[model samples]
Target: MPTRLLLAFALLLASLGVRAAAISYVDEVQPILTQKCVACHTCYDAPCQLNLGSGEGALRGASKQLVYDGTRTEAQATTRLYYDAHGEAAWRRRDFHSVLDAQGGQAALIARMLELGRSNPLPANAKLPEDLDIAITRSNTCPLPGEFAEYASKNPHGGMPFAVTGLTDGEYATLTQWLQQGAPVQEQALTPTAAELSQVEAWERFLNAPGARENLVSRWIYEHLFLAHLYIEGGDQRHFFQMVRSRTPSGQPIDPIATRRPNDDPGTTFYYRLWPIQGVIVHKTHITYPIGSKQLERVRQLFFASDWTVDAVPGYGAQRRANPFETFAAIPAQARYQFMLDNAEYFVRTFIRGPVCRGQIATDVIRDNFWALFQDPAHDLYITNAEYREQATPLLAMPGQFDDIGDLLGLWRNYRDKRNEYEDLRRDTYAAAPLPGWSTIWTGNDNALLSIFRQHDSASVRKGLLGEIPQTIWLLDYPLLERTYYQLVVNFDVFGNVSHQAQTRLYFDLIRNGAEVNFLRLLPAESRQAYLDDWYQDSGKLKMWLDYTHVDHRTPSALYLPGPDAKRSFAGQLLSRYASLDARPDPINRCSNGRCYREGLKAEQRDVEQRLSRLASRPAAGLKVIEQMPEATMVRVEFADGSREVYSLLRNRAHSNVAFMLGEELRYQPGLDTLTLYPEVLSSYPNFLFNLKASEVEDFVGQMQQVSDAKGFEAITQHWGIRRSHPQFWFYFHDLDARIRETQPIEAGVLDMNRYENL
Candidate 1:
């Protein structure tokens, strides 16, 4: 062969190979559609309508067709032809058949083309039809079930609807069966092995690939716990205790709102049940007492009784007679002021060491620092500057020293240390083995801290505190702190949904405990500054703006630069504070924009009023009168049948034939000391209907004897049509006359013993 002839032959061979690799509808696309799209996309009864399973029917629709890639129709796509014209020279190619013909002995080429087009494979448990019609159409020639009724007669249209149609349902089934049996190439061609498919299948299983474990873990921890943020009635004293403890006439459990946290204690176990949600703003003063006072009282009352448990108080023994909430609340404004002053004194004693600290001057300085620290809503850890303290600390001082600048200036390091130590002495109780340089201990990973707290387990605590917080934290901004707490709750279901309502209280406790461990661990600012002074010889350069008084820095002593300078810092600070840019009132001004704040206050008031009104509107189940326990505000009663119980108000308790449970219902008694029960029991189900204000407790019974199992119920839970997770046999018969006028109709009374068992 001549050199030019040889080059031309090589070019021809390359062109043929490229054509063989291309994904054509006939050779590559049809099979994928048949396996995946047809099951849901096609209507079996409507054969003449669109059938996505078939290439011709899939793309030939006239009105709002499915897959239009700008130019070609699905029917047109069935053909393997491409036209190329240059002036007078026109060339037409039948690429699919040509590639197949050229690569007649190359089964690998065909298999590779199929592999490239099959990007996402169907799952192993995919639902598929038993029988399907495969239409093989090319240009004007078509083969579709509806079009091929008359195969023999040809009136130019070939007795077909459109295009050339060929395969019948039975013929297609046989072809599919043969194709699925390895779609064998000629004997001379190489046959791909099953192992090759295993690799392909593994690669194609994208959803369940490498990163899926994390997603699965996340879904498992968080998907079911329902959360709602709404204003509670009558401020924080909403009586959810009565609501949760109510029972139905049939002695069934009711309180659906109760969110229980995981319990790990070896001895006594307790659930952090649903309490009335209370909201609090950290800096705001007045909103504090109204919301928190009643809650503290309730928590104290519950824990004081034999039912609940609380581990400790801020600076007191765990077994102390006084509740921390009460102790904290009992401190008069004067005492609180003195407490802050005493804290300041302690801070001065520790850091200044040799006192240049005049008592009043020290108090004034600490107050200033404390105010500055409190002003920073983000609560960037440590009022003083410290770096890398989140992972490792240089010295142990106190929380507010870095965070409460007012205290820092008023009282030095010495005072801070003493105060912290004193608080630690008050709260520490040994529940685990001692570790080096630590008083009390617990053992758990950082991820398990919230759970440990929920379990109130000391060993678990030692474990959590021993490990590092997976990522380095620079600053402890309120929002970021919240994010960490949220993740903790989600991963461990720690406080269950209890923390959602008590976020402020929980975080305060966490910070307090952290302070007990090492005050510096909780606040890095004090240490960060110390680190900067130690490392940066050119710290003077960074100090130029230290004197500037911007919006953030109102004092000459304070530095207001954004945290972790992009150029100079090595460790990024946790100063990821979300700066508010919108029109917020000048916080210092009592009423910067009176209208907005007024409206906000009004809105809050309206919300409380509305909630209270709705709660008040809830029909009292029944009345009761207490005779023996005249002073008891609420009384409990057991029903005659022993199936139901309720609580009622004391006055109502004495008047009615029944006794009450926590003051909400009348219980029936059949005997001498008989408590007469009401005809029906009521339990409140929150968030049931649209736009409804009141809580609802629709009649519930042992699984309705015979009820309509809504369509798609079993299908969703089924592995296959034949097997379901919950299965039952039941029939309900309705009393038609009684059901006619009722709003919540007694449609039918179900009598399914299996229904209850299945549930």
Candidate 2:
């Protein structure tokens, strides 16, 4: 009887152990962490300096916040990520907080923050029955801790997921069960897959190619110098990468924040912020995520462009400046060069597409257009993103004999200031490009700069087509062209890769607030030019602006977004975002627009989807040109092997859609992502490039067939805005280079002699 009893007890103990084992880091705890926690906590500057990336990071704990620090007497803590590491060190929840103690040793802080909001009236003081002296407050968890008594009086459930929802019971149990069983990491973290490794290696090989390295070196120099005041066509007022739309402080109304726009376009914003940190000359290479165990460094020596001997920096009036580029430039020249050559992978990864000819312009189009090869700049014409006139004098007007509000003499007080400094800069730093000089009062009248791209042969037609293909001879420094090229080739992302479904989605961007129509024509031509010059610089703003305005504008009626009332504005339908509910419209209802618009969109969506459905999934082979218009406006196509026949974009689209979308825009069916000129748009291109005699029989059909390699013969069944489907689309660097090389006008030499792909 005793032995049987003992065996029963042993079996029960074993069952509990097995159940605990099931609640592991891999099987249970991590899933909860990944879904509920990691998104907000993973980046370089994790909130409160608390990194929850791994078990070790969570255990290492959260740093003491700057909000509680006695340095400044204000409640305004920085809303953004705290990047300055000196202010905080992560503190372990085990040592300072309650939940870890209750869990025996498992202080998964995430589970703790989450646990607070699970129960409704949050145990008296935002604490569990077990919580003792921990500083997590109950009164306004604006995420700051106060004295003990304050916990009972203020907002109790302020801990985490803040305004967002909390984890489910099963998720909570999995995490707690794992922690109770000693939160050990049950399995190994994933390594890079075979495909990922192969992709990285391919990019590395291309970047290290001799031409790619030299191109990178040149590019780094140009961005560092030129971005500050990249020449706008008319403005003496130079532009810098200044924040146009200021981030609204938390608790502030959203409409106030949305109203402000920047003075100038913020394109080339990344170029201004190249040297993000000062100490490390080699930047930490960031690849497409799952940043594995190994980290790579890029030799940042190429980024050093300025002669640092000069004093009185561009933006800082009286303050002395430190040149972050000094340590790298001080390195032995050979060593510096070798470093760049060795770390080609890092350079390639960071290389992004350039602003000019950004999206889908053909590389050989220049060869087909007015081809000209001008020589490289003799020496570096260093440009900086510095501004002037505003910074020449002190900000506050000083008293000179008389000081009154808006006094003329007081306003003019600082005119005498920095006069000599400005003179020296002009004399020494801004002197002639080939000779010694200082900062000149550049009024965009530097004739030498204009004459750079002005080739003797193409002098008459210089302005006719160019500024399409960027010229470095016109560039103060040409290497920037290469650097931008390499980065873009590696990734080539443009505009979040978001193709808008409706014109309503253009709010914030392209669309200003409450405007009936979003058009560039609304602004003056000069303003339009200014806007275009700096349009793509702020990727973050562009995406956020897109996402925020996307939902509000989805309904056909602009008045549909009924302010911030959660109940009315919220479309409760599952899987439907923003006014997608198919509720019947009531004439008496204040928001009838929502219901009506949703139904209309659904019907339209169905119609387009059905029209698209008529398309055969795969293209019929050997499609032949039966007939085409002599002017090349419309063409008739027929399949040779099969009876499949169709007319699509080549049938009904306008000149703008075909020329810009098909030719310039990168968004096209894989095989068809090449330029075949439309007659209307091709009037500008030199006629000598095309075989005009072969126009009647073989205008678009032959050209499209040749470019598509028989792949795009599949008539696009999908709609462009509604539900566009595409073939295996690729802008593969190697393949693109091959095509460009093959299609190069042999009659004319290369326009950009230093183009990395050609090299």
- Best lDDT goes to which candidate? 2
lDDT of 1 by residue, 1-759 (tens): 654454355446555653222334544445544333232233211122233334333333211221212122112212110111111112113111211111333332222222222322222232222221222111222222222224223322222111112223332333333333333222111222344323222322321223333222212212111121111234322211111111121123222222232111112222112223211110000111111234334422322333322243223222111112232322222222222221221221122111111111111111000100111221222221223212122122222112232343343334334334433332231112121111111111111121011000000111111111111212222222322223233222211222222222222333322322232222233444343333222422242123111111111212233454421221112112211211122111112232212134334333322322221111123111111111111111222333221211111111121011112122222111112111111101000001111121111101111123433322321321111011110000011111221321211111101001110
Q: Which lDDT tens digits does candidate 2 get at residues 528-562? A: 33332232223423433432222111112112224
Q: Which 10-residue window in model 2 sums to the lowest lDDT?
A: 750-759
lDDT (Cα atoms) of all candidates against the true structure: 0.22, 0.26
Off by over 4 Å in 1: 1-250, 253-302, 305-437, 440-528, 531-759
True-structure lDDT of candidate 2 = 0.26
Highest TM-score: give the candidate number: 2
Residue 599's lDDT in candidate 1: 33
Query: How many pairs collide in each candidate, listed in order?
Result: 94, 21
Candidate 1 worst ten-residue window by lDDT: 451-460
Q: Please, what is the TM-score per model?
A: 0.17, 0.30
